[model samples]
Target: MSFRSFLLIPLVVFLLKCAGSAEGRQSGIFLPTELHPDYPGCPAVDSSLYYYPVIGILTHPGDGASGRLSNATGVSYIAASYVKFAEAGGARVIPLIYNEPEETLLKKLELVNGVIFTGGWSKTGSYYETVQKIFKKALEKNDAGNHFPLYGITLGFELLAMIVSEDKNILEKFGSSTKASSLQFIDKANIEGSVFQSFPPDLLKKLTADCLVSQNHKYGLSPEKLQNNEKLAKFFEILTTSIDEEDQVYVSTARARDYPVTAFQWHPQKSAYEWASSSKIPHTEDAVRVTQLVANFLASEARKSTTRPDAQEVRDNLIYNYIPTYGGKAGKGYDQVYIFT
Candidate 1:
């Protein structure tokens, strides 16, 4: 064979090898040799998990609705810490003003992936009715296979318990206000499918060993009451308990049996966000981590939501449209608050 023929033969073989490599890559049989810090295993992106999820936070009545932060009447407010918590978990927030018209509130629900019932003092009146309506809406969304989730904090927790039990008097008074407490896990406690599932083993242990979370509510559900109440028992399982100042054992955390609903009788956001000197909020590294991981769990659950609304419409209703008042400077319970009349 001629020398030129031999060179041509080598070039043809080289082209075939390159084409084979390309085909293998297209078929996902080939991966990059270089490892990136962000993509350590070069894992495929999960298109099913939404990266742009929006969470709706329901507003509470009064200025410092939970702690007497402000005396502003005819106004509703959402603590900035709650907003920060959602954002920390990679989710944007929209305020679901509790006192808004039923039509407006329902419309806003359609635009969100998840909802948060904030801590507040108002457990009765028009606010209570609004919460009931929204809670049912969330359940309906889940029933329709939308994968929507709800998080209830403090008063929010009490509301969920009351709504589920259909008994407004389900909550009993406990001297847990302004206290730093440690969680005591219950027997057969179900954490495997909860926000605590994302918690590191060490942190989970510390939750029981140390006072890593804060409690500042006047009312809570006892373990016995939760089990005996047919409705609450069927809806939520007690996850953790804490002793109040009066030596009363109350449920500190609980998770829904079937739905993506979790409730906290303590303030998980205070550790990392609030700087109120009056609070017994823990600021240790582990405490801050508890706040972060909880928020991360919320965002993760929201990512599973099937509702993907128009971006422009979401942007218009975001919490950013309202400015946060620096309530902390005035010695308010919250550092910042988004007040709406």
Candidate 2:
């Protein structure tokens, strides 16, 4: 054979080897159904001792430290506190980084019973778009029987509202204009005394008589604008009227308005500035109560999924003790007990 024929022979062998390697990789991708391990389902139980796993996602801070910081103390610290509170009542906590690709993040989400969206600096343009996309996808899966619970803090709370409403206007109304340090309140008048009122009667009662909400940040939701925004109007309607007051617990923050997702313009995790500011700790009791309430809410949701009736009473007790109490001068008795529902 000529030199050309020899070269052709080697090329054919090389192609054959490459084909075999690719086929092998393909086989590794799909495991056999029988090879997958299956544990016995959880037996029916009447105890509150059972535990559920919860995952917390950390967002990228727009300060160019997208990958450097996983826990922005203010966000992570509060989240960790909540996780500990949840564990005290029988729930496992898992912290996950949110910088992964969408598919990988979704896979990680599947492993946890619930999700917590931590607060951080907001991104710009396509970055925000991608972030919103992931949230929307997770919500869709959750609604479609995935059974995963979701909670957001600060910026995460804003994202949650945006996702549920699917209103891009959220960005235009709040995102584009407000600075991180600004605080805005919901304008109750826009709702025209409807259920969508910024402060529903129940929540208004809590704020006026029960809790002392602070105003620290520069930006917040304007109840009037939120109610007037044609798209958001419906969401506010559902959150106010449809969700049962007994099923939902509202927390008063250092901000305005009443809604499902409890949001605080001030960082409760900032123990120094928030608690120890002025040679005396401020709102320490309130902070502790907020953390406990969050933990209790998560535990209650988990119990519902596990069908553990024994935990119901414990859950009710928690709500009864923690809900804010009304009476006396507003914001005068800064007792932690007042915030406990």
Candidate 3:
């Protein structure tokens, strides 16, 4: 071949490969970064089907007398709603028992792509040293370029805030409304590129009209508290706020800085999975859609991990060695007392 013809052949091949990659991205197969600027640094989605993610729901100390019926000391449980939430988001769920040995917990963490610190009544108390360690380890993994996602709801949210702020006193007794209410989208520009980036316009719009968020805690982070605090202001960008019945404004949701960590002061799962007297949870069509949005988003993020827990690990941790129980209530498609010994 002539010299110019030989060189042209190599250039054509390289350009063709580049065109194929661009076509893949243009077809909605994307890296997390392309989907949203806040996404973790992870492998791009290929044309292959997405992985079915698994979630570890951390069980914790209970707060009330309702668990008096169970033989366990403190109810280490997850709402059936959360299980349904995971399933709806195209993932499977498992219980992460607290106090497990660090190695065992670490093994399980390696198996799942995400972990959820469910809400409970530990506002003024402490998390199991194991739970704390697991959380810290997950943070380290994400910081080290592993795309692991952690979600905290209600008390879970408070706990994360406490951890990131390194201030035990960051959470305070709300003293205002704890009833179910919708949220006000504050500083829309802030959430524009975060986890909610893909929100349907109608779904995002309903945040103002629908009573979708179920609030049940007396302890929460207010906007003032978030702004004035050094650690919190630096660690999270507040995405939404709500005016309680007593006109008190609180920080309802936040996304972490430089990580795929998200938290909510309101119970997004309650509207679909919880129902107790005085719970006052929302159950409207809008409420269900909002719940599903969160479920799908988190699950989708969970799918970003390039690995899955081993089958033996799944059997040992989620199925064979454990017994599931219900809380005596009906949630989406499961019992209230779900996934506890």
Candidate 4:
């Protein structure tokens, strides 16, 4: 064949192949059935499931140490482990400064699909009021047909109990600080509609049989007290309990009955992320899996939210804008912390 004819023949074949591929796509032969918007008899795409979910993490007043990490006035901080946990579950984080003005704080709430009340000591004063306000907002969002989730960790759990009980003294002292404990599953029925439902059976068994969780709080609600408090009992279903150093039983895991709110008296984030020489935080594979599973659970819950916030506003408020300091070297329990002034 002539050289020019041969080149033209190759070009014609390439064009025919491209046309066939396009026809194949239009005929559903090349398109994934689940992803095609107009595929007949296929399940409709769930627009409600947002993949790029944003979580608001409430910051504590100070670093775990008093004026040790930062001495600036009106200072607040978020442990980097919590941020890492959210990311592990396929979510981004935004810091909800507890001390920010009411108007600003409420605005930030609108941007987040979920919120995490970090484990902290201040469950009173403005911080307490702020947490209560945010908790109510989350409930309101759920009540209004929007699926919003909230996670209360350690001290956050205590705050939730106190807020729901409407009693500041609801929490009793527990010698659980810096301790590793095995979760004692309460009842099989309790896990039926809860977050733990998504957990693997083997991991759930390990959670009950091994010390795969870390507890580091001075106060927690006893199972007996949680049972007697009408409001608390009505609001949350106790999932698991753990014994403290003194062998006192305290509520370790619980979830709201009607809302997408969950509370943990143990530090799930510390198991894989935080490294402190003096801490009892487990770093085993199962322990790290606990963190991963919990993170994924919360992120999945957040994805159910229908809030499609402005991308620019979310970008401005994301935790990525902040830098974390190596607090672990400073003798603090946290490996890294984002200190805000």
**Please, what is the whole-model Cα lDDT of each candidate in the order they appear?**
0.88, 0.40, 0.72, 0.89
lDDT of 2 by residue, 15-86 (tens): 667656856445455444435556344657766433544443343432122212223432212223334444
TM-score of each: 0.86, 0.48, 0.78, 0.86
- The residue-by-residue lDDT of candidate 4 on 212-326, one tens digit each, is 9988889998999999999999999899999998889999999999999999999889888888534688889999998998999999999999999999999999998999988
Select the stronger candidate by TM-score from 1 and 3.
1
lDDT of 3 by residue, 1-341 (tens): 89999989988997667657866457545667767998777667674334768888877655122554355654555665667777788887767766555676677777787888887765443353555677798888887877888888887888887777788777867753347787787777677646667778897888878777788778888888988989888888889888766778888888887788888888777677656534467788888888888888888888877665577766666633454554444322224544444
Clash tally, candidates in order? 2, 24, 6, 0
Screening candidate 1 with a backbone cut-off below 3 angstroms (N, C-alpha, C), the clashing residue pairs are 64-69, 64-70
Number of the candidate with higher TM-score, 1 or 2: 1
Candidate achieving the largest lDDT: 4
lDDT of 3: 0.72
Error of 3 at 263 (Å): 0.8
Tens digits of lDDT, candidate 1, 1-341: 99999889988997677657855446444444423345556568798877899999999888763535556566889989999999999999999998888888888898999999998788899999998998898999999998888999999999999999999899999998787999988853467889888888899899999999988889989999999999999999888999999899999999998899999999888899999645578999999999999999999999999998889989999999999987777564778889888
